[model samples]
Target: MTLDPKEPVLRVVPGPTDINANGHIFGGWVLSQMDIAAGIVASRRANGSVATVAIDTMEFLAPIHLRDVISVYAQVERVGRTSMGIRIEVVASRDRGREEVKVTSGLFTFVAIDADAKPRPVDAPE
Candidate 1:
């Protein structure tokens, strides 16, 4: 799916299991959400299976509350012969809050893989 910065790939409330001891959403949970969102973009662009190669410049900007609605946005940043880069941003909206705040952002790298799990070339943009 084509994910726009204005749109989110996943939206849901954070449950107790998603929280940390600090009374806020777990950082790992947030990163996992971002990874899923990025995977969608990568898979669609690659037209095949892909594996996460790396994540760069990941930053958590704000705390997410338990009842907050999390939105994960992803977009393709670039594509290489066998790798693609995606930028993902996680935003949160609380019931009592007036607006959504950006909770996290990162760059994800994925490499296209064939049926045999070997690296495969990704199609070039025309």
Candidate 2:
């Protein structure tokens, strides 16, 4: 997938401890980052608490290196009565931002919740 040029919701660099035996950043680390980014967009759209209900699709396009700067971009793709779909994309900037690669992409579903932790209408005002 093409990396979007828009500003990312989050950016982070992985440390040595995040690397796997294969010398690449662990998949779980990037997955968590995607979840965090998606949650931010989901919560904003829901205007309150939100929880991840499903990951519709996830693709690991390339390996992430330790020195790479990871940027996570997320947007609300669809909205229902009580759930929304978030599209998340991750890019890695290597060699001090000279090289950018699309590392991961995912579609996550989140349910809007109320104080009681029950699903609520996504369009409900806060």
Candidate 3:
């Protein structure tokens, strides 16, 4: 799938410290970004706090360089009683946004939580 041009949930540029021995951005760094973006979407949909339950699927389509600006797009793809499936896509903008490349994609599951930190119905009134 192509990267959506709409507003991204998060955008960041990796630094030299985030690079790995391969001279590319660390995979874990991108994963963490994805998780953070997905959490934002999940929490918005749930109208409260949410916790990541699982990473259902993840794919690395391309490498990210330090000069690349990463844009993360996340949305709630599915909703259950107390859980939500978030779809996240990461695009790397290089050459000052002249080129956009799909670097990673992931599907994450999150559960809505109450003040007690226990799972709660996602549709419950806020």
Candidate 2 lDDT, 10-118, residue by residue in tens: 9999999999999999999999999999998899888888999999999999999999999999988899999999999999999999999999999999999998888
Q: Residue 102 error for model 3, in Å?
A: 0.3
TM-score of every model versus the real structure: 0.91, 0.94, 0.94
Candidate 1 regions with alpha-carbon error over 4 angstroms: 124-126
Q: What's the best-to-worst order under TM-score?
A: 2, 3, 1
Tens digits of per-residue lDDT, candidate 1, 48-97, equal: 79999999779989999998888888889998899999999888887766
lDDT, model 3: 0.92
lDDT of each: 0.86, 0.92, 0.92
What local lDDT does model 1 show for residue 74? Answer: 89
Per-residue lDDT, model 2, residue 70, is 96
RMSD of each: 2.5, 3.6, 3.5
Per model, how many backbone clashes are there?
0, 0, 0
